[model samples]
Target: MWIVSALFAAVIAIFAQLTIPLPLIPITGQTFAIGLAVTILGLRYGSLSVLLYILLGAIGIPVFSGMSGGLGIITGPTGGYIIGFLPAALVMGIYLEKTRFTSSHAIIANIIGMCITLLFGAIWLKYFANLSWPAAFTSGIAPFLIVGVLKAIAAALAGVVVRQRLLSAKLLTTKTVSH
Candidate 1:
């Protein structure tokens, strides 16, 4: 599980580089990778992956969007979104774990995760960037709404298929039992 979680963290770093730069915050594949990790790894391992990713970034690893990293980025304007990934993954993974890990449920969970990320980001932008609430919403959430939904859907479909294949191959367990 740790190895898989580490691999997923690396996956997130790679995806983070696929950025379409925006003014305040850039659009990146981070969220898609996040959704994929949660859908496939479930609550414990998925959240671990997110935590590893954040810790790597916090320790000066260039794992964030645009090849940026370090504690500064973790405390920067876009930091909220990055930080929010943990809770988002937790919620998403929990949702899947509690219900069915179907494409439909994954889609719903991913969409909910997206909103959580945006909410954290907008609030952080408002304070860190010294922008008004409306300004934060405009720069942080507005531009990403449509694209975020699309990414969520794609992540859900892809994640479900990949997870099934992994399980069939005995590469992943049905669930991680708590110690």
Candidate 2:
């Protein structure tokens, strides 16, 4: 489990580097990876994997967006989004774990998780970036709406297929005993 968690954490880091620089927060593949991790790993291990990734970045490893890491990044303007990853994973994991992991359920769960992430991120942006609510919304949430939904759907489907494949291969347990 720990090994898998570590691998997922590493995967998150890898995705984090796939960034397109923006004014405030760069767009990256991190969220898709987060959704994937939670859907596949479920609550306990999924959350733990994100926590592990955060810890690694917080400890000064270059595991965050743009290959940057350290306590500074966690406290930086985009830090809230980074911090938001934890709850996002937890929410998605819990929902996926409880439901049948159908396409609809998975998409809905990931969408909810994405909203949580945006809320945290936007709130943090308002404070850290010294922006008003409107500004925060424009900068933080607006840019990601369409892409977020699309990514949520993609992540959900990919996660479900991957989970099924892993289960069949005995690399993962059935949903009931997963994690």
Candidate 3:
């Protein structure tokens, strides 16, 4: 489980580099990686992977978006979204675990996760960047809405398919039954 979690953490790092620069926050593959990790690894291991990724970044490892790292990055204006990944992963993983690991459920869970990330990000950006709430929403959350939804759907579809293959190969284990 630790090894798998570590691998997922690495996946998050790699995905983080797939970024599209924005004014306040770049559109990166981190959210997609977060959804995929939780969808495939479930609650425990999935959350662990997110924690590991954050820890790596906090320790000055260049594992975050744009290959940047260190505590400053986490404490910066965009830190909220990065920090939000943990709870988002936890909630998403729990939803999938409690319900079903099907694509539909994963999609719903990932959307919820996306909102959680955006909420944290917008709130954090408001304070850290000294911006108004409306400004924060405009810069932090608005641009990501459509793109986030599309990423959530992609994560769900890809995650479920990959998870099914892993389960079939006995490379992974799950407590919840897939639909």
The lDDT of each candidate is 0.92, 0.87, 0.92
Cα lDDT over the full model 2: 0.87
Give the RMSD in angstroms, all C-alphas superposed, for model 1.
1.7
User: What TM-score do all the candidates reach, one by one?
Assistant: 0.97, 0.95, 0.96
lDDT of candidate 2 at residue 46, scale 0 to 100: 78
Error of 1 at 101 (Å): 0.3
Tens digit per residue, CA lDDT, model 1, 28-120: 999999999998888899889999999999999999998989999989889999988998999998889888889999999999999999999
Candidate 2 lDDT, tens digit per residue, 22-71? 88888888888888888887888878889999999999999998789999
- Write out the backbone clash pairs for model 2: none
Number of colliding residue pairs in model 3: 0
Ranking by TM-score: 1, 3, 2
Count of clashing pairs, candidate 1: 0
Q: What does candidate 3 score on TM?
A: 0.96
Off by more than 4 A, model 3: 175-179
lDDT of 1 at 17: 98
